[model samples]
Target: MVVKPDWLRVKAPQWERVGNVKDILRDLGLNTVCEEASCPNIGECFNAGTATFLIMGPACTRACPYCDIDFEKKPQALDPTEPSRLAEAVRRMKLNHVVITSVNRDDLADGGASQFVRCIEETRAVSPHTTIEVLIPDLCGNWEALEIILRSQPEVLNHNTETVPRLYRRTRPQGNYDRTLELLKRCREFAPWVYTKSGIMAGLGETDAEIRQVMQDLRGVDCDILTIGQYLQPSQKHLQVNDFVTPEQFAAWQAFGEEIGFLQVVSSPLTRSSYHAEQVRELMKLYPRQRV
Candidate 1:
């Protein structure tokens, strides 16, 4: 087992505020990607009253070895009430920005695109001012399904590249690297107004060169935002950590991403896709794009 470096260690969060956020999520029966994916920043995000809401599941359709979310159990039926409850959570939390993500529901015909539309609409109904971002699956390359969600017009549409193309088969066996890039490219083509975002997890054996290439690929598709974070093994059964990237390297990637024209790049050891995601509200003000 590889030992974690001191820089990767997380600061303990204030339990009082953390508990308050948990209380609201439980009361409304909502799930968050922060908790489900075992994100190291859960405490800090919860303490600050922000969470990336995981809709359609705590269960996923694909069994990616690196992920902490469950895929063994039978997936549940879509909960029609989930969107309203999620909106209520936003209303109660008074979030200025909200992120809605989901497990890959491949069993559904549209890969749960309709559910995403409902969530966006419901959230808007309750909190019109809240900027919405959706971290979505590739919808099995179903561009039509993607269009359904894109039509809802969330402020940001995020899909993770997860790892470099060379690692896709081992790390994300079911995910297609070309298709992942195509999804982001199509998002820009279909909805020019929405900011396109993608993330990559470093330290799963990808070299610094490969990482930079992925950034270039994303930028080639006009991706507006990029986040590169270190990968942590969820458990012994999951994929083992190959390396722990240092803080300086993360800083270098941040600098490189910005130089390549990414409007925002959040890179660090503990930076998950949605870490400090609310900051995008300010990004919008600085580089606002009108709906096309």
Candidate 2:
């Protein structure tokens, strides 16, 4: 039986002009993970004047049991002008840091790698000093495709492990735990200057030992940043929450991540991978001599 976690109270103030912003996104035919994934921190992020853009397309190629994104055999064609439009949005928002992510576009030849590069270039062209980060797919373990994005020189490259290896068959059937580790390892190898990052969700029936093992695997890959957050079930159709990890448990994990040598660790009940991204970018800037 799955243990139901206590629903934490979230009473973020509504963004007054959020609907206008949503309309703009809809008008441009763009998708945001914040909307699609039902992120609880959407109001806070939008109110603070930043949003993570989901590029390529919203429909995913793989159906992870924990996700609510639609899995369609064939998705819409890539938007050639998306890069420019995203740049325009960033400029309009006056954003100094941006996070670009995408659905698993396994059908594309370059795995939509080139588009990722284009978005970075366009963002930089319009906002030269803006720090950019990308939460990329594993590309089905395609190193060449990953290399394409790394070459674009984003400040941070993040991909999520999502859950423990034992749960892969149930949580992310299409994903491979070992392959994900290899991907993170290669990111560090390809772009030594770029800060490599990954995330994992707790309260998925994973034992404490299992979580520790996942952290060790990440460390083996030289993952510089780590994020641990409670996994809330997206919907009834998705995986049921096994437990609701408490705030204290999250704090313990944060301390453990630091003890394991992660340069930065963000673990909290309300933490998502992209939470406080602006602050993360600012911290990156402080370590100028360090890798990007």
Best by TM-score: 1
Lowest summed-lDDT stretch of 10 residues in model 2? 1-10
Clash pairs, model 2 backbone = 193-292
* Candidate 2 lDDT for residue 49: 71
- Candidate 2: residue 239 Cα off by (Å): 0.6
Per-candidate alpha-carbon RMSD to the true structure: 0.7, 2.0
Q: What digit string (tens of lDDT, one per residue) describes model 1 on residues 161-278?
A: 9999999999999999999999999999999999989999999999999999999999999999999999999899999998999999999999999999999999999988999889
**Model 1 residue 87 distance off true place after TM-score fit, in angstroms:** 0.5
If scored against the real structure, what TM-score would every candidate get?
Answer: 0.99, 0.94
Cα error, candidate 2, residue 210 (Å)? 1.1
| lDDT string, candidate 2, 160-183, tens digits | 998999999999988999999999
Error of 1 at 23 (Å): 0.5
Runs in model 1 deviating more than 4 A are none
CA error at residue 284 for candidate 1, angstroms: 0.6
